[model samples]
Target: MRLICPNCGAQYEVPEDVIPQDGRDVQCSNCGDTWFQPSTQMMAEEAEARAATPPPATEAGSVDAAHTREDALQEPPQDAWPSAPEPEPAAAEEHWHEDPDAPAPGTPPAAPPEPEADPAPAKRRLDPEISRVLREEAMREEALRSGRDSLETQPELGLEDLPEDEAARRARQSEERVARMQGLDPAPQAHAAPLDRDRLDPQPGSRRGLLPNIEDVATNAPGETKPATPPPADAPAPPARKRGFSRGFLLVILLMALAILVYSNAAMIAESLPQADPYLSSYVAWVDQWRLWLDAQAQALAAE
Candidate 1:
């Protein structure tokens, strides 16, 4: 029914059922100490045991009916009649034994009554500074929790700045969206008519898109009202400059003249360089040998 904090000696009254048989953890309001409080079941059992134990008889008159009958049988009172009617057999049998409820003659009386429990003290109010600090701490914790939850659930912001081309693409997408909402195309596509088969060249394939359309090739469609664009009068005819020989052609001509000059004066040229004489003679001998070999092969083929 009551609990006391060991640290602060503060008392608390709690219902019997509030504590289970296994005990419960309780915090002291005064000292803020937490401890396991024993269950009240054991206390309740002790109270029941005390209630079952009968009180001791203090006065002779206070003796039980069985004790009075026994005393009456053993010693008759002087004023009482000698021939008092005897109790009924059943009553006599019932009063034959001493009262089991009464204590023995030399036994002590019941235990002294327990002293009244003291009233629980009133809780002291917290200091103003402490209260303010606790309040601020609670507010800070709540704010931190809320901020953390928001950070977890809130989506991160993607790149807000975009390149010019990306911005243009997004603009186009928005325009297309607006157009779709209004039941219109954002970019209308041109539908080209099929060209007539008769106008296409016979040599070209019969496929529809194989040859270029006559209107497209001519740069103007028939029946168009726009006048033909005449050539600009200020544009002069292209000049007809005479063709000139490239450096490579002139180099080839020079090489040919050198070859002619060297051939006409071959002996003099070989005499001027002794190394040239051996090379020239070897080349002529090789050409003559090739000619003889070709003639012999021709004659052998004829004989065959």
Candidate 2:
């Protein structure tokens, strides 16, 4: 039997029994078009019915028409006519026919197997020594908690059970331990003597002089004798020598005096000496400015 694709007019030579009597959906190998195809028996019956029907009347004088009809009748039936051999089914079409779910040709390849869902990450196992250490730490923590709870519930020592002095000593020791841990100095002992107010204040009979008496503070060693008589109060006191200015001081004073004289007469010097006029003029201007500043300072001070 011959089948023709309605969409692309591609023909396939299939077995007569390939299509059932009830008809079935068929797909085109060339165009991938699908449509319901009637059975060969039903198609033959339809053709026979079409042939039994009469043709419309025509003019009897039309000889060419009559001759064409006669020739068509004399010719073999369309089923007996030789047809061109069909090419072998393509690999893709054969595969598609074998497996309906197979993808069509020219489609993108299946999405790379969805990356296999990255497989659930395997659980990591801890080292044996690490696990042991962890367990030991947990047990130690549990024991510490238990011990702390018992300590919290235990009765405290009373004054009768522990002496006040001993308790104070223990508290001081604990405080010192904590201070040492924190890099601090421990407190001084309570037995240390406090500063005496009497010692800080002068005695009633003591003299209120700017300089203290050295004789009172001095102590004589054992077996040491005191001098029988003190030195006479004004027994020929040595003549006091006077201090004079040093040579450098005198030089500095002389230089200062010369500078003052030159500064005071700078304008007159510039007029008298033409060679030194420029230098003296600059010096005189500087001196005049200094004098004006000094005068302004003096006036401000007087006003204040």
Q: Write the per-residue lDDT of candidate 1 for residues 163-271, one digit (tens) a residue.
A: 3343334434554555454556556511122223344335433434333354553443334447778999999999986556676788899997986676566678788
Each candidate: RMSD: 36.3, 29.9
Residues 1-304, candidate 2, lDDT per residue (tens digit)?
Answer: 8889999999999997889998899999899999999998888899999999876456555767889999999988776678888867785576654558889889987876555567789999999999999999999999999998887565744533443343344445554555454455666532233322333225434423322343533342223447689779879878876545576788899999998898888778878898998887788789889999999999999999
**What would the TM-scores of all predictions be?**
0.18, 0.20
lDDT of 1 at 232: 98
How far is 186's C-alpha from truth in model 1 (Å)?
26
What candidate 1 gets wrong by more than 4 Å, as runs, is 1-268, 302-304
Which segments of model 2 are wrong by more than 4 Å?
Answer: 1-245
After best superposition, candidate 2 residue 91: deviation in angstroms? 99
Q: Which residue pairs in candidate 1 have backbone atoms (N, alpha carbon, C) closer than 3 angstroms, thus clashing?
A: none
Model 2 compared with the native: what TM-score?
0.20
Model 2: which ten-residue window has the lowest total lDDT?
192-201
Report the number of the highest-lDDT candidate: 2
